[model samples]
Target chain A: MEDVTTLTKIQLDALREVGNIGSGNAASALAQFLNRKIDMAVPTATILDFKDIPTILGGPSTLVMGIFLKVLGEISGRFLLLIPAQTSIKLLRTLIPGCEIDDPLNMGEMESSCMREVGNILAGAFLNALSALTQTPMLNSLPSMTYDMAGAMIDNVIAEMTAVSDKVLMIETSFIESEEDLKIHIFLLPEPKSLMLLLHKIGVN
Target chain B: MSVVIPVGMGELKVARSPETLVVYGIGSCIIVSLYDTKSKVGGIAHIMLPDSSGIAKERLNPNKFADTAIPALYDAIKGESGVFKANLHAKIIGGSEMFPPTEDYENNIGRDNTAAVKIALKKMGFPLIAEDTGGKRGRSIEFVLESGLIMLSILGEEPREL
Candidate 1:
């Protein structure tokens, strides 16, 4: 019945290192894909109570676009890349020039598929890095896109995690592209057991 | 004085007349709201999972699962206002499959949650009066205690009363 909030300083530092490695790989991948300079903040890994999750990502009612992928293999979990609606449109514009970014909900199937691919590429980059660092084999499912309230989307992640623990372990990193005025967040929610496996691998109890 | 009571995950609350009960960030999770029109008293449970069986809990968190939450809601409404179970009506909302399924991940938890909530309510003999469930969008719900009116709002969409 240990909550994620009780992680000792050493554990937090270890997790932050993992976050840095994973997001570092992801940022480079995105930068290459967009063909632009991308800057990322220092990654943070922390355990938070379930109820506080909604408020952390700009409150419960904030509208956002989420790209989700399920990670499978040695370490199973979920990965998410979330951007504001405006950021998503800008991303679309950058990815497919002349493609209409207006109407976040209404988009061609081809455009939607492009977004999905963007998710796959970004999620793959982070998972690959984590997999390499932990020496754990990991694979991801095809990416899926949804536009909704950020709180509601996070509820799905929390619901999946509840079977194992009431606490959620989150690795969050924010990145920005100066050319497009785009700001996006990358999140990793490793299963509680898988997280322990990671901590054990890193020599933390 | 009318107070806005916020119901977070795995939580439930009861409010009297003129007070409002609200639950936010309901995606795939179900919100079961019970109200008694005569007494102007109501309760809302934010249920995260469908079933509670096989889980070890040192303390019973009734609001965390549909199976336990509905009966708890029935008792709370009845105990606080002397309202009969028959007089109570249920409105369910926020079981949205927020994302499409991938090759390996089948995102059907929203349907599972709605079904479980239906079964739980049926077993408790509480009739369901309204529901807004099963979509790709997330929803927020507001229940007014004065008239038992439920307001459902999807982001970027106009709010509707049910």
Candidate 2:
């Protein structure tokens, strides 16, 4: 019912702050899991209408392994973890020692589930941060992994979002391990109602 | 060389000959393509949702839903280029699973969109010709007006015609 495209500068800053804290937690968890130092860029937000939503997280058609987790309960939305095809090999190796996916496109079930596990850890950490801050109980669905064009991987998610809201608020944080040429993008998209509730909880309303 | 135009989600594009209309990275969303053989009036719509039933009227875009996009694309093609409805053949592409069937089985928006688009086209009396739908792969399609071919390309796969 509210217009997200018209979010004020303060709202934008609040959203960025939310992304920053959540991603910070996820980044630390990833670093600890991988036993390496991972540098994360400051989180940023991309709020756009459905007409422009498909073009982000890289051009729509860029080959990617999209890992998704549905956030449920007190606050709801989706968490999309995008690991580009080029990063999957290195990422898998780090996530699961000696278990790297040679061909991301033709991944086996084991390989796919491994990616989902990665999604679980990252999204869990991010959601934990929100839950802790808000003192609300929230749960995430089982992680789902798909290998496809970025546009294709995300269209259905966008479709569901559009059924209720005109715009999508994507809070993106990039984890860069430059030495390994490994970078992952985590996008947090909260439903509009949940977003309002979240902002209210964070004292930005 | 002919110009290539990119169509984004919840939008539609119509152009004449020597031009191509492309919608990139179609997953779970459906792309409705309409082209006239004689007039070379080509159009492509990247529709996100199946319908706009409960959507608010003020912010609604006709091109965002299959139920509305089909008629809008038809009217746009005719209005912009004066092509007859009978001259336009319809092709549908891109209705991919966002998750494996094992996961989000009940809520495959891609499947719903494909079905919705088909129903809308049938209701509008458009002759449906070709389609590429329902798979795990995402597609990027190019609708070339010069030849009226929908070049549908998926990752790790060769481009194919719809």
Candidate 3:
């Protein structure tokens, strides 16, 4: 059994570098779509244990949109983008300038559509970066949205990944531009039987 | 007058007035709504986790988790200027998987939360009036104060009243 604690460090550096590249691409995409200057900062990367997710993100509450993807033939994972409710509303208003939404509690169809598009752009950029780094083809699943009670969200992801792979690697990144704060969490879970194959391909084992 | 009692995770709110009680973003958590038409009173609780024992000692705020929150909800509704027993009605929504690939933790939390709620409600002598639970989606629930109608919106699903 590999030490899960230490295992994250080995890939942490590489994931951070990838995040830098991915953020740049995503910023460009958003800027082009919104027709405005979108300033984004490359976030410091960290590895979060399943237990610490809630505290790391602020509270035991989260709103997430995730997309699953199969990459490098042997590795399968998901790209998750998260924002707190306050930040989501702020970002949405910015993205949809001149739209007046009175109730912050109400999420109308237009807001949902905008969020979905944002999900698509972020997922596309992140996956493209992964493909380039690994020199592998990637296939994507439709994006889905959810709000979770903090730690439960990460716990669910770990539990689900364990069924397919004994170990799961999580890469964490954040985005902040002006007043918007967005966090992106990525996971790479290789099926148990395919673990060795992936390790060999990455020259890790 | 409409009194909007916002039930945060693991918290419950009850009002005697004909006011709407709402709980937002009930993702994997469960929202329990009880109403008494005769008394013209209603309440809602949003429970986050299945058990309070597993939570930190400081988080014992009944409004933050399922196990602790349900009991608090009962006390709030039944203890004070609450409703008469004969006029009470109940409904529940939200308790969804939300995440598919992570069936163990993500999916099970919703189920566990619902079970805990049912057990608590049964023990409290409150029968379920209606329920919309279980799926791979999140929901927002509102309990109409005057009519005691529960309105829910689930992702990709039509908005409905129970």
Candidate 4:
């Protein structure tokens, strides 16, 4: 089994470009949804060990709101959108701006569904860009929303990959809405087979 | 002084009295905590898969699979902690169906993992004293060796001792 850490710089750069184009489209879609300007940091593509996953999200036990979806069809993988609890509330508020809710924490089912819808839109936008760029036909499973500890939520996603590889290829982009403290991370975790296919598409052996 | 040992995914840890074995963020994966009251020794394994037979090659991590992990945990406790098999009790946590169930049973990893752990426990002759498994939520668990208490905390719920 080849180690992901052994990926050449060119392969890593190719992955980073994929993240950039995908997140760029996602940012535009989010900006339209919120009717506000959005700023995105340069996307980062790196390989992480199983234990390093939680630390990147915050900590093993930190509570986070995540949206999970499985990518089917040509490029099989997983997509996740994660934000801190408070930031998630901010996202919920952005969706339902008219509602006079003081604390985002004190939200209800309506808010939760709204968050799921937002996740669907963002993930869809990102995948569309990726499909176009790589010319790979990809479909996504229904997105599921979860408010849980970062460690647990992320652990489930990467569990299957553990048997195949010790390291995971994680591409992430952080974006923020204008004049709000809300920050969200868009994560793409492609399966090993899918990753190799992507690398091959990008002309890396 | 009490020590808190964290059991990472596919990893196992063994600790003595005055210490706690903890694993956080148990989604579809399960954490098997074994403790011997007589010796005040405990070990925790964060298992991601049910069986090792499905894997392609010889993997180094025995703790990643339930069938391998159960015997490994028993050996670690007995050899290093000097605890006999008869004195060891088990507490299982996690194995949450984080996503909705799919038509393919093989894809339903949470349910599969729970079943595998149960089978392993039965085969090893170690009684399952308590369990907090098969839920839609994730859990963080702590096993305190001194009191043989397992503390479980859900996201929006209060922490409880089992």
TM-score leader: 4
> Model 1: which residue pairs collide?
none
Of candidates 4 and 3, the better by lDDT: 4
Give me the runs in candidate 3 sitting further than 4 Å from their true place. Answer: A1-39, A42-65, A68-79, A82-205, B1-3, B56-59, B102-107
Sorted on TM-score, best first, the list reads 4, 1, 2, 3
Question: Per-candidate DockQ versus the true complex?
Answer: 0.70, 0.65, 0.08, 0.62
Report the TM-score of chain B alone for all candidates.
Answer: 0.93, 0.94, 0.85, 0.93
Question: Model 2 clash pairs?
Answer: A60-A151, A152-B25, A152-B26, A152-B27
Model 4: per-residue Cα lDDT over A86-188, one tens digit each: 7876776667867555553466888878888888898999999988887888787778887778887886788887775678889999998768877999999
lDDT scores of the candidates, listed in order: 0.85, 0.82, 0.60, 0.84
Instruction: Show pairs that collide, candidate 3.
Output: A60-A150, A156-B106, A160-B102, B10-B63, B10-B64, B10-B65, B11-B63
lDDT digits (tens) for residues B2-111 of candidate 3: 66776654456787656777765555667887777777777787666666664446524555455566667766777656467666666778667665532222236678
Q: Is the docking of candidate 2 incorrect, acceptable, medium or high quality?
A: medium
DockQ of 1: 0.70
Q: List model 2 lDDT by residue over A1-205, tens digit each.
A: 2557767789889989989989999999988888888899989987776666556666776778888878888688888898988888777766666774687976777777778888899999998998888788878888888877777777766677766566778898999974786789998888777777888888887
Lowest lDDT sum, 10 consecutive residues, model 4 chain A, at A97-106
Interface RMSD, in order shown: 1.8, 1.9, 8.4, 2.0
